[model samples]
Target: MNTAQLKQEIIEYSKKIGIDKIGFTTADPFIEMKNRLIRQQELQYQSGFEEKDIEKRVNPALLLDEPRSIIAIALAYPSKMTNRTISKKGERRGIFCRASWGIDYHHILRDRLHLLEEFIKEKVPHAKCKSMVDTGELVDRAVAERAGIGWSGKNCSIITPEFGSYVYLGEMITTIPFEPDTPMEDRCGTCNKCVDACPTGALVQGGQLDSNRCIAFLTQTKGFLPDEFREKLGNRIYGCDSCQTACPVNKGMDFHFHEEMEPDPEIVKPLLRSLLQISNREFKEKFGPLSGSWRGKKPIQRNAIIALTHFKDETAVDELIQVMNSDSRPVIRGTAAWALGKIGGEAANLALEKAQQVEKDEEVLNEIDKGLSFFCKDEVGQ
Candidate 1:
């Protein structure tokens, strides 16, 4: 059979295996993407999680030998939960963003790509294929955009006409010289909703992001979150969805095609207090499957403290006091101290005063001081 027949079979087989969308493109160097990446690095706009080598990221040949074509795939995730958990007066909850809703997309996309690799190998015994998901060197969005999967939206997410911006992208570089699909035209004309909606103004301009100020990036950090972004975090425990949620295109786009992509409401939106003292094993057992938990329980726990502060749930003060006084990690302890101050009460103030006497870490002491300052401000106002 010809390469065209093989390509057709791949497309048909992709549908059978739950690949929501597939497109093909030549394995040419992404010239425009390279320039943009260089600019992002120059401006310090890139998330440090990306591969450091710019050449390797934009060049398919660097990743695969004699690469002739690339296949891009997208799997749509649910924007709305079916059995959504709601937060109430005493029982406030923290949220993991929709991207982290279900089982980690990294695993799900890899399973699909592995199947595709096997199918291609059977057709052409000597065919070469290299696949990667979000963690890959080749930018998944760039490959997807080039393969006509979707147009890159202003929010820096691929926006498909059918699925909006709610899709997880993956790609495979293959030696087969299949015909490339025409890229979709940019449909985000005159829409700045995503940019305007960003809580920390991380979306500096259309298609450009300053990851340092991004809530999504901030939530994953394992430190005392900067004071500026802390309040902006609201109740987000892992990732922020302000920009995506504000996109007019993504409105009402909720697909539950893959069962693995379905979110467990309890895990994604757990009670804020419960996370404060969760054991390491308990956290892993509950959240390890979700991509957001990759940073371990520290960041999530820290964010949960901030979330408790966001709600000003006085009930959480006791737990926050425990975390502030006894947590092993200084970052978590310091953040809990800061949160305790934010949720000021007699108990929280007494805890902070006691912590100041014994806390050895200078950073934690500073946070304890900052927490006490809130009470000072409150007293002066009264």
Candidate 2:
């Protein structure tokens, strides 16, 4: 069994199964990535959703016994929604970034990896393999970068020459020793557009990211969004694509390679007001398949309130007032109160004043005061 022939077979099989790109690398410890991860830890820049054990993250040996090679796969997703939803004056909408536009990539990637693993086992009966998507211990970008799948972009995304940065990455560690692919060179020369376009300045520099300020991480947080990022959130209900959108290589890189990765106009860009009162069951039914829903509806609801304020959608004032007064979750209620303040008007002020009388939660009260301060500013202006 020629290893090179086997690698070619795997590559061909990957194409048949719809894996847009595939590459291989030695399962050696990622020395440079470990140092960067340490720096990220010292800087408090990690998103905290990653595997906590740094050793497992950098060393493939810790994950699998005598791992020989790692296979990295990429699937291109649509950058622009083909069937777009209209976000008009009265009908305001919130977005789930392009990454979350379609069926969750985790499921799709895992399925592809599983198929690849089965094919390898058929060829090599003694082969042992382990696969993971974004949530895996190994850094998907690092593996992809080493495996020649793509270069690590300034936006902290894997930017392939064929698909730009609009690709979902996953990897598999295998015992079969396969020839490694040449890693791509750093092609993002003198490009700082991704850093400039970050809404919260999350991209600290070319390849470094401060996840604390990243809207993608911030939106998944269960607590109330910080005051600084509220206005920057725009209409994004989950994740942010500013950095990717700003990349020169990603310009006009709209790929509809996978049907499952296509965005449903209504689901990804849903009406802002509808999310305020969505039931748990309804939220699950509507967004459970999307990766953004993994954090549950609380953050989505909180972000939706902020989005309403971003637009100053007067139509949502009634909905925000109702949420401020009636919602069970303090974070949601408090966010709604703050949104009412940001979207200041007589109805919003009246609602905040009314909430102060009966709202027992201390945090919600503080948010109510914040909301009232906007009216105070308006008064002083007058």
Clash pairs (backbone) in predicted model 1: none
The per-model lDDT (C-alpha) reads 0.93, 0.94
Tell me which residue pairs clash in candidate 2. none
Angstrom error at residue 163, model 1: 0.4
lDDT of 2 at 371: 94
User: Which residue segments of model 2 deviate by more than 4 Å?
Assistant: none
Model 2 quality (TM-score):
0.99
> Over the stretch 334-361, how does candidate 2's per-residue lDDT look in tens digits?
9999988988889999999989999999
1-382 per-residue lDDT for model 1 (tens digits):
4989889999999999999999999999999999999999999988799999999999999999999999999999999999988999899999999999889999999999999999999999899999999899998889999899999999999999999989999999999999999999998999999999999999999999999999999898887899998899999998989998999988889999989989999999999899988999999999999999999998998899899888999988887888888888999899989998999999999999999999999999999999999999999999
Off by over 4 Å in 1: none
TM-score on alpha carbons, each prediction: 0.99, 0.99
